[model samples]
Target: MRSDTLDERSAVKLLLWLLLFVLCWPLALLALLLWPVVWLLSLPFRLIGISVEAVFALLRAVLFLPARLLGHKDA
Candidate 1:
């Protein structure tokens, strides 16, 4: 009110609202408006993550079997 310009005050107010919308509003509407699109886009990433996990699990099992057979480890 003293010296700040109207544009500056309006910009500050807009920034506050923008922050709130980005932080809280999205959480509430998650999977509501863009469920199908987001899920579709993420399908590849999800599959890759799952495949990597599966490969790691298989390797762990293979390594454990050999070590156990040689009496080098308990598990």
Candidate 2:
């Protein structure tokens, strides 16, 4: 079966979390509470990464512009 779909992935995640809850409810609760805080803390770093990626893409396009103008096609 195709288990790569979003619904299947979510089901798998829920099952794993349920197992964790059954084994150690306290740790599961801690993870649930801290997940949002950790994501928030990393937001700035994510934005910086996106900005750097954009800059690199722009640089690559600039570097390739002359080749594109000279009728060079991507191989």
Candidate 3:
């Protein structure tokens, strides 16, 4: 389930990047060139986002423990 969500997210990002690239190749090329630097600059925020996601996932699992133990399948 988590893998599916990750795959979907990656696909969406790729599609959007492709759309931008098609619309303006020069700008896209510049973005491609700058991606590594931008990503490095944003690394801290990305880490925070991942941490928050993990916390929420853990909270959800705790909240759903009873239903899971009773064999109530998630829809």
Candidate 4:
């Protein structure tokens, strides 16, 4: 009885592992194939995000210029 339980558990584990591999392989392959394309497509959005970040940074610098010139260094 003990041996049978152990064998069953191992078989179930193997089956689950196999199922996971089979299910995931196609997705992995698809991602691998499309990663560059997806990245290319998202380049514009990434550029926009960077531009917005830069704009905000410049705005902050301009807004704080007076305080900085007055020697009010933020601790």
Residue pairs with backbone overlap in model 1: none
lDDT of 1 by residue, 1-75 (tens): 555687789899778767766889875366356768888999999999999999999999897897778878553
Clash counts per candidate, in order, are 0, 0, 0, 0
Question: What is the TM-score (0 to 1) of candidate 4?
Answer: 0.66
- TM match of model 3 to true structure: 0.53
RMSD of each: 14.4, 2.8, 6.0, 13.4
Rank list by TM-score? 2, 4, 3, 1
**Top TM-score hit:** 2
Pick the winner on lDDT between candidates 1 and 3: 3
Residue-wise lDDT of candidate 3 within 27-51, one digit each (tens)? 9889889999998999999999999
lDDT of 4: 0.87
Q: Considering lDDT, which of the candidate structures 3 and 4 is the better prediction for this target?
A: 3
For 11-73, candidate 4 gives per-residue lDDT tens digits of 997786667558897766676678799999999999999999999999999999999999998
Superposed model 3: Cα runs more than 4 Å off: 1-35
Off by over 4 Å in 2: 1-4
Per-residue lDDT for 16-60 in model 2, tens only?
Answer: 999999999999999999999999999999999999999999999
- Candidate 2's TM-score reads 0.88
